[model samples]
Target: MGFRQRTMENLVITPAFWQDRRVLVTGHTGFKGGWLALWLQTMGARVIGLALPPATQPNLFELTGLAGQMVSILADIRDRDALAAALASHRPEVVFHLAAQALVLPSYSRPAETYATNVMGTVNLLDAIRQTGCVRSVVIVSSDKCYQPRATACTESDPLGATDPYSSSKACTELVAAAYRSSFFASGDHRGHATALATARAGNAIGGGDWSTGRLVPDAVRAFADRRPLLVRHPEAVRPWQHVLEPLAGYLILGERLYQQGARFAEAWNFGPGGETAHSVADLLTKMAGMWGGGATWRRDDETHPHEAQSLRLDATKAARALPWHPRWPLATALQMTVDWYRAHLDGQDMVAVSRQQIARYCECEPKAVAP
Candidate 1:
């Protein structure tokens, strides 16, 4: 069916929609998950997080004081029994699955673990939701790398492909979700399965409180803070860089629409920056250095690395056209927000407050819908 661009004055994420809602967020200890959890809390949603312990020492889950704020269950998504138990216990109506082995470089060394986690982990989560039977909406977050690499931006209907273990695992994940939705949670037969599932394919998400190794923004933040030169591996690689909140907003919007609108919004969707906003890694870093002006510097890594894509972008036209969704910040503004967040954390400021402030600021901006 032909889609028309959706536009509205203010985004309709009403408190009435999320208030007192129970949300289950897998991988809540990671960067994006933590931010999403915090945002849900701001909307008065009861959040239950299930994932392995924080991947890093200074992870966002700990820094934002999420443990004290919500019910946190530390367990691996690969453990099917444990995941099922967590879901049965929480009985959440909304499930946002963000748990995965998210790095391309790490996946090369641990291909088995990557697939076990990203692929089976998804299978486990969906099965658990089916077994428990309380979930109404599930937004499975997958990366844009799940798409076959093309010179042009990828749409939701693009043929699935992957170059590395991480990317391939995400592709497998997308397939898994599709199979599950078709076989079990088919929207037409919601009597027994009664779950609506959608996969969110988003671009490279950049923000602070992310200390994952091999990621550009967090590595730059740490190096800049330590007064050391940041290393650039694939400096020429282009990505659709968006703020952390951008896709999270899309995910929430998708989740809400799925709950309210059902089968109409239950499918794969892309939430990514479009056009000139998608920049190269080198250009992104140069702009980030300017935002973080302690004379922060970066040098090209002479060492050889695993095969990574040189050009990747996401076409979020489906989301922009079918729903009230669009990127809220320019790349520069997102970089500045990243720097500002890291600086605030360094000064020993209350990160919970800072994160809330940023989310509020993002929500205040008017969404500019894209043309179909």
Candidate 2:
């Protein structure tokens, strides 16, 4: 069916939909969080960001200058008291929880910190919502890695488990959400009258402005920028890559569903590309090199690192059918947009305008409606 010909049975975006809506985004200084903050601002939402200080130099948060766009709070998610105070003062209508020790390698180095931030930090946010009694909906951002190893594209109903510290901690966060939603947010519970919570599993994301150390695309870009050979680990491993905004749009749409349907829509959802394309690290590097005009090369990392998933893909059909969600940019276009952003920044273009322009471009291309 044509995009416009499809029925409007699911939530979709409009310019003024988020106007006057209060949204609290944790991890606003991080890569995906920064993008979400900027997107919400474009929708005219009142966004308040809560997270630890932006990471050291070469950070996406600082690179995008997102702190100036929202009420950025310098606090750790593990600090329940601080998080609670911020939630109470802000009284957000919707909360997007994205703060965590997001790196798998670092999680191996500091397993305890990972658990504290990912597992307990989630508990803290849930407890704070219980206290505030003002939050209407919350979307807990998790990863496709939360699923147990499977060669096929995993669905949301597949068993949930994780091998590494980072993935396992996210699994624990999912458990926390399940428990709280069942125990406290049920129809008969005291706090059930106020809030509904859900989880979203996003596939591997790639875009510009990401400067995180150890990530594939960012590492490649940084090494190339410095005229060094990028290191490639697990070059044969496959991932479902899409632009960052694709999943962010899914999260916001799910948030809107939770607002309308309340407990009925409070369930786990997957946001990813429509199909599995086994784009390995080598394949991604080749794509990036081609997009960057052929001056980049890579070598395998010598030191042994934590194990990441060998192959990963997700089935977002449920989101497509239930929420009418569809990915706008295909794989090649996503990579080109990423490379173009980095090129613009390196060429001394105004990055703030560049980022905003990308956001506008994505929205304009978004499919307004679709058939299941």
* lDDT (Cα atoms) of all candidates against the true structure: 0.87, 0.82
Q: Write one digit per residue (lDDT tens) for candidate 2, span 25-47.
A: 99998889989998788667899
Q: What TM-score, over all chains together, does every model reach?
A: 0.95, 0.92
Where is model 1 more than 4 Å wrong at Cα?
Answer: 1-9, 189-193, 369-372
Q: In candidate 2, which residue ranges exceed 4 Å CA deviation?
A: 1-11, 187-193, 366-372
Candidate 1 matches the true fold with a TM-score of 0.95
Q: With candidate 2 superimposed using the best TM-score fit, by how many Å does residue 11's alpha carbon deviate from the native?
A: 8.7
Which candidate leads the pack in TM-score? 1
By summed lDDT, the worst window of 10 consecutive residues in model 1 runs over 1-10
